[model samples]
Target chain A: MSAAELHNNEMIHGYLNDLRRYLSRLAPHETQEVIREIESHLFDVLDQQAANGQAADVAEILRGFGDARQLAALYVAHIEEGAPPPRGFRAIQSVKKSVTASLYFAMAVFGFSMAFGLLFIAGAKFLLPESVGVWSTPHGDSIVVGFVSVPPMATPEVMGWWIVPVATLLAVGVAWLTRKVLLVLKQHM
Target chain B: MNSTEALMEKWEVQLRKGTLELAILAALQQRTLYGLELLKLLQSLPSTTITEGTLYPLLDRLKRDELVDAQWVQEGETRPRKYYQLTPLGNKKLTDLTRLWRQSVSDIEWLLANPGPQPLPNTGV
Candidate 1:
């Protein structure tokens, strides 16, 4: 429509506001610019409609552009393309994110393994008597074997008490080393 | 029409969105202008359009490519505004695009004039 004949300024303002609110929540810094672009696009469409004698109210005509979800997606794409991180920063960020995820996954595995070990100790204590005794290896090293609070003793099937502290320390040591290895891997990758 | 068809049409319109960037660049080639001025010129076009926000990013891309140059100018009682002008590279590209565009127009016109049977022969020329 000709500038002289335009009459829907207030309606256009509101329409732009609605679109702006939807876009702003998706991308804060660039929302105003996005609103301006959508306004210009809507204006062009309204201008064409006016020329065609189909719509007298450009603002009213634009009130129908829906799909808040799609609009949000568009804002995301716009920000992605327009404000991408530097390649170096992106590489570092991705590595950090992956390593952090792997750490959590490994922690879960450690927790489950510890739980199983405790269960085995509990089951052995419940089924077997505390009458076993400590034994000596060929190296003249003495080893103690028993469940929690039971006297040091040996059984052919049950793991030794020494094994408990050793395995716990070893598991902890491996996890700590793995964390360092992950840090090094991230640094190199 | 079904809602799916309406969505498809919207997607179709979005795919045609590249023309807006092309049109904006073409308009900026005519004169050095700030964001609002360039948007105004594009809105004045018969078959092209652009938004205020869209121009900034497109201009940023063009600037990054060294296709356009921008400078901030301060006026007495207003905040400085950035104005953009086509760079030498941009001018060179615009010339190339103009040639290709005009050639396409003429090619389409020739096709319209000489209605062919079945499709134009496989002129591998």
Candidate 2:
């Protein structure tokens, strides 16, 4: 169906948003220039289509132009580098995107792992009997430090042996994941 | 398609991309035209199949490179339209590109007509 017939303003807005976001890497003025020209061209095409009594869907025409990101890449590449701009940069960009996604996934997995690991230890200490718990004693509950479980009744020597190193490793991992998540967010934003 | 056909398709796209600017310059050589008029003119040509997708970016690039200049002109009750005309630099560039294109065409035509020799004739060895 024709975008004009459908009067799909939301789809148009979403398309423009994607184009704008894709073009955001260009210098502000350059980005604005490309977008303005594109907008004007799109309007002219639509007007011509309407004048011809043919309801050519604006969305379909935009789709014919291909993906907004790809169009933006072509615009930016040609504008910046002149005619016959080198291709394959989009492949590189996609790889970068995948890496960023991997970082997010890794961060989420690590964050959930740490949180659930700690919660499971706490849960086991409270729910399970002291005799059956990983290291809980009859006196009190157990606390998790990295891979080790430390009961309140444990010896100071055992605590000193595992707690410091395990805690340090877990803290470093959490900190690293947090930093990675922030870095990825910063890049996207 | 096979690898060679795919390669030809890729080259065809590249060739088209290279020629579009020349075609736009050639179109603007005569007089000023608005985006829609220019688009219509190009569409009318048997050699050009460009839609708005390729047109605007090319126009913007031409304007950026100082090959063409644009102005907003209002006519009657209609909205203002950006009209484009070639600059002196664009004219000179167009001439050079046209000369090169003609030479390439001539060279290719000659090559087509005289494609060297057949391999070993009808030798069954």
Name the candidate that leads on lDDT: 2
lDDT of 1 by residue, A27-46 (tens): 35456655654555566555
Candidate 1 — which residues are off by over 4 angstroms? A1-20, A32-181, A184-189, B1-18, B43-45, B49-74, B77-82, B86-103, B109-125
Q: In model 1 chain A, where is the ten-residue run with the lowest total lDDT?
A: A152-161
lDDT of model 2, residue A9: 53
lDDT of 2 at B45: 80
Model 2 ranges with Cα > 4 A deviation: A1-6, A26-30, A78-189, B1-8, B115-125
lDDT measured at residue B8 in model 1 versus the true structure, 0 to 100: 89
Q: What TM-score does chain B get in every candidate?
A: 0.75, 0.83
Each candidate structure's TM-score, on Cα atoms with residue i matched to residue i, is 0.43, 0.54
Could you give the CAPRI-style class of model 1? incorrect
Backbone clash numbers for all candidates listed: 3, 0
Give lDDT: candidate 1, residue A50: 68
Q: What is the lDDT of residue A35 in candidate 2?
A: 63
